[model samples]
Target: MTSSNIPIATPTFGQLLRSPVLLLAFGFGSGLAKKAPGTFGTVAAIPLWYGLQFLSPVAYLAVIAVTFALGCYLCGAASKKLGVHDHGGIVWDEFVGYWLTMFMAPAGWLWALYGFVLFRIFDIAKPQPIGWADRRVHGGLGIMLDDILAGIYAALVLQGTAYLIHML
Candidate 1:
């Protein structure tokens, strides 16, 4: 929701396709926080993480893989329609990205914290190719690719953390 007395006009389905505001608004509304939407969006993955962790590591990886692939298409179309790239609310990329970050970490608070920090850092920093992808790509692929990079970064950091602490 925009923070103004002026009401936002609703876009038709056609218009929404040209604008990312609608889809991102819907996705990030899952958090509904006035504070950092990205942090809240990452927290929003907790319940999902609990449910998904029941499966094996391979299953978790598969889920992230499939979700990322599908999100690429969906996010690209939404961004194309909205004419803005990587609007804040389309945190489906964030969701899968965090899940992927957690892939190597063992299930527990330590692993969760590691995932949270690494994903948040990479997501916020948008280092190297992440920034490149965000700027260069258009549509859903653009929206999703940076987070995938974030996930990979987080995964590596988690691996290093595990080694440092001897958790691996």
Candidate 2:
């Protein structure tokens, strides 16, 4: 059955705390927020992004790649365990997407904020292929794919903006 047909129920903090996989899938409790859990999850990613900035670009990309693969498993498994596909509480996708959005972003809090805003806009808007993937894909990959697309879109916009600023 598709996510639309599955009834969604938020997992309690105790439930999350008991399952390591669920905790990570839930963005280390950031997804526990009653409202805008995705936004909170993205916010939770900022500290990680800050640390990732010290890595070489290639290393950073590798980290994202690894995390993306992990997220596919984590998100999928969490959905299966919860009996709900793409539960809003499964925000691992947001963590990866926000990181991808900040890829190669200019080094500064301002740029980080810009990346956050851009990523949120693209993720929330879900234009074109992003929305398509969300509708068409299934399982953990489905949960991650849409956000990956959104991240790509946001990254493009963020990089372009940085380019413009430098050019001026």
Candidate 3:
């Protein structure tokens, strides 16, 4: 393999988190797999949720908000560095989107599944803000915005369902 192809540094989990390309590449890894990579990526987020939920809701929200903003910058940078727009492998956006989906929902496998399915649908469907972000926004913001919006929509659906089910 080419030296350029290899990531040289000891992979810093935090740096990877901050890297738009890494995130995008992760998502792409899911996208490239014959099976559902999106779902896999969403599943990958469960560990983070276990930790993030420990913080006060306000703290959690703040972290998510920061992550969203950082995602925009890093995603755009990585896309440019890789000389591609919205590469399939970048799944960091998926990570954040899934995080958004569970923001208010009762933490349960059922709710997560619902959020995951709903998030994947809206992400793929790209309706309204998702559509708008996909088309108009450029760079990392463009890459991540659509999924985040989808997350928001899915979160609503999941939360609503939870309310109806008396799970919230």
Candidate 4:
């Protein structure tokens, strides 16, 4: 049954903590927040993004590839468990989305902050292809696609802003 027809089963925080897929899909418990779970999920990604800084650009890209694949599976699994597709609690998408947005960004906390803002704006806005993917895609891949597009949009804007700043 579709989530709308059936009652959605809300997992307890402890249940979420116990399941690896749920834990990752929930952005390491950031999704457990009573409000703005997506925002918190994105924030939870900061440490990961910071850790990624040590990798070379190529390695970073590789990690993103693996993470995206994993996100799709975990997010889909979580959605299935919750009886919802792309539920708010399935926030692994946001983590990877933010990471993609910050790919090759200027090296600094300020730049990361800027990337975070831009990613959030684009993800929330869902312009063009992102909106299209959100509507058209389904399953695990769908969960990741829209956010990936949003991240790309954010990355473009962030890169342009950084370039302009550099010029100035």
Candidate 5:
């Protein structure tokens, strides 16, 4: 069958939640949104970031490490089941990416919002290495890698901006 003609099966929300991988891959149902699922997934990430924000830097890093690993597995598995690579519904990457973007960010709603905006910008823009990874990678690691890079890029910019503001 032609690539376009291949059938892609998307699991229902009930089906997705039945599996740990699918549940996370769908961003706890945020990815099931009829419109702008990625945006919804990112929004869902905000509260998680808030909860995780208080972790010590070392603990935060540990959590990010684990989340990235879990996201890679779950995202890959869900994409395989859905018969699509990087399906829009596979948004665990977005969740991890946003959390990483806000890592160690100063405590404030404004900072959180800024991190959200910057992460979404970099993710959607897919500039440089992020775009390269997205195009060339496959499977679960591939699914999570691009967003991870985007998050790192956003984190750098966010941290640098905070530093500059402090210096000023």
Candidate 6:
């Protein structure tokens, strides 16, 4: 059945609390916001990115890899349970995307803020392949792919900007 035909309701906080998958998928409750849920979800990822920054690069990448794998499953499962395709409340993808954007970032809150802004820009703009993936893909992987592209785009711009500033 087409996603449009699926009958689904926004999951309640109680349901999110009851289900581990839902909890993570909803970005630790940030996705529950009535307005700008995705933005809230991305904001919720900041603290997590802070802790992750302490890890060695290899370890950090490993963690991201594992989280991405788990997100694929969790996001897909949550979408299925909700009978929705990439529900706005499913923001595990945002967590992963933000983490990816922060990879190798400079050690400062300024860098983190820059990464956040860049990631949000690319995510919201959905330029080229990012938008293509969002329209063409399905399931959990689909939900994650668009954000992944956005993260990559943001990461490139962030790193380039950092490099230019450092060289100045």
lDDT score, residue 9, model 1?
Answer: 37
TM-score of each: 0.77, 0.94, 0.78, 0.93, 0.93, 0.94
lDDT (10s digit) by residue, model 1, range 114-163: 78988999999999989998789877777788888998999898878788
lDDT, each prediction = 0.72, 0.92, 0.73, 0.88, 0.89, 0.91
| Runs with alpha carbons beyond 4 Å of true place in candidate 4 | 1-8
**Per-residue lDDT of 26 in model 1:** 35
1 or 4, greater by lDDT: 4
Worst-scoring 10-residue span by lDDT in model 5: 1-10
Per-residue error for 123 in candidate 4, Å, reads 0.5
**Candidate 6 residue runs with Cα over 4 Å from true position:** 1-7
Instruction: Output the better candidate (1/3) by lDDT.
Output: 3
lDDT at 81 for candidate 4? 75
lDDT of 5 by residue, 36-127 (tens): 88889999999988989999999999999999998888887777777788989788999999999999998899999999999999999999
Error of 4 at 87 (Å): 0.8
State model 5's lDDT. 0.89
- What is the model-wide C-alpha lDDT for candidate 4? 0.88
Better of 2 and 3 by lDDT: 2
What tens-digit string does per-residue lDDT give for candidate 2 at 1-168?
A: 224665448778888898898999999999999999999999999999999988999999999999999999999999987888899889999999999999989999998999999999998999999999999999999999999999999999999998999999
TM-score of 5: 0.93
lDDT of 6 by residue, 3-116 (tens): 566545787898889989999999989999998888899999999999999999999999889999998999999988888889998999999999999999999989888998
Clashes of each: 9, 0, 14, 0, 0, 0
Candidate order (lDDT):
2, 6, 5, 4, 3, 1
